[model samples]
Target: MQKDKRTSLTDGMFLSLMKSSLKGISQVILIENAVTGFIILMAITIFSYPLGIITLSSSIIGTLIGKLGGANENNVNSGLYGYNSVLTGIALTLFLTGPSQWFIALVGAALAAVFSAAMMHFMRNTGIPILTFPFIILTWFMLLASYKLKAFQLSPGLVPQDLSHWTLNISGKVDWLEGSFNGIGQIFFLDSTLAGILLFIGVFWAGWKYGLFSILGNAFALLISFVLGGEHSLIILGLYGYNAILTSIAVSIVFKEDHNRFAPISGIIAACVTVPLTASVATWLLPYGLPALTMPFVLSTWLFLGARKVLPRL
Candidate 1:
């Protein structure tokens, strides 16, 4: 009887271990979605304007369909369905620079949505993990689109002057520290190195409440972009701000805490990135273009306030 009791206790312990393991897996899956969603949103914001609209619309549609079609909240299948297609659409849009690029962007978005749904369906039925399916489909689609699209040429009027000229013009008028501060203040004015610094400051200060992961992720993505020969433009800096806000929202959802202090502090840091330089640059290049220096901070404030409303309550 004692032996039988011992055996039963061992079985119970094993069952408890299994349950704990499953719970941990579920938590990880949820976190992964949060990360992926932020990444996709950042990608869209980086594209901005009409292209951002197309990418966002396609991703939202695809994610909704996947959720309804049997992709669970914390499953690998859901992540693939939601994020992969978004990346594919954005990538296609970037590669297609023709005058007819708008049409091509829409087509790419459609293709990504349809293919993601179809692939998810296939994987579900076969019981295979949908781990790499999105990457495979997106890569192939982008490659095909690139091959078919001809290079586009822009008129001289549409092209901005050399970076050096802009740099020299700004440097001549504003001292380095003052210029950097202004740049921080006007982060959304365009792509500038000062904007990058502000983003880093936001991530760092937010780390106090949300932990180090948010800052680490932003830095990592930035590092990767720099290594890939991408320009450190103001647009890219704006993208980092977008990324940090989304990440903060995600962490709030998962952890169920406000991190209220973190959000505004981060915003101030983001603002600092552009304020000094953006103001000076606008004054020099387009004296009437105050909007250029101010729009990003306005947008960031609006986005964060709206995020507070839309995000699931912790």
Candidate 2:
């Protein structure tokens, strides 16, 4: 009896740890691979302590609430239930300062979990992946609402940094490879070159194919943005590139199979469209002082995927 009780307790703890790790990595839209999760957790922690604390706290809270709300056990265990919540945590922490409204972050996380579950149910039959829509919607609402409330003001003194310090390529231009690596790191709201390098390594460790598509996305976005004459500094800082990176990867790996001739083509299209779409969305949201968080990726992925049904031949 004693041995059985000890084993049961051990199993429970192990399961809990696995769930937490999955929730952590789900921030990058990857499933519950603990190795990937550990890398992402380390990346965020190294970037900022407050970001780390809120990410972990909101993730755990979201998971518990998801389980209570009867979200699919597999989804909860795999951390799908917590990904949007993690995004919520990161989004709020990235924009808002101080611990005073940490409670708001927790509340937003809980709502994100609920919205995630609802989206999963609604889209279950539509064959549409509800990737991070909850985060996009909730964060947008929070940002717009905050304009009227003093508690949610933008992080004071957080101006965009000048890009004078980045190492330039031979032509004194933004290095595509460097921007590609930074694009991966930018997913977690990191901007440092080392963070990007670590994430590039992490994705390769997760799956070589994922790494490949990520690089493809980044490069395609960089090329297109340059051709389109996007702001030089923002392009180099990778501000205009991260969405395309994620969209390319998602359209290729997450939504379509490699066997589909259109997979690579769709990825390229997603990358190309990301810059313009993000710029358009940013303009629309500028009045609200709300950043267009992941709108470009979400919209681009949807366009590419939805187009497949009518045009099946690409």
Query: Which residue pairs overlap in candidate 2's backbone?
Result: none
After the best TM-score superposition of candidate 2, give how far the Cα of residue 156 lies from its true spot, in angstroms: 3.5
Tens digit of per-residue lDDT, candidate 2, span 1-314: 99999999999976785566455565454545667776777777887877878877778778888677776777777777778888887887777765546877888888998998888889888767888799999987876566588777667533333344434332346667666666676777777787787777777777888888878888888888788777666676787778987887788877785568778777878878999997788666654567777889989988888887676643
Count: clashes, candidate 1: 23
Whole-model Cα lDDT per candidate?
0.40, 0.75
lDDT of candidate 1 over 161-216, digit per residue (tens): 44444442211221333333222222222243543344334433433433344443
Output the worst ten-in-a-row residue range by lDDT, candidate 1.
21-30
Clashes of each: 23, 0
For model 1, state the Cα shift of residue 63 in Å: 2.6
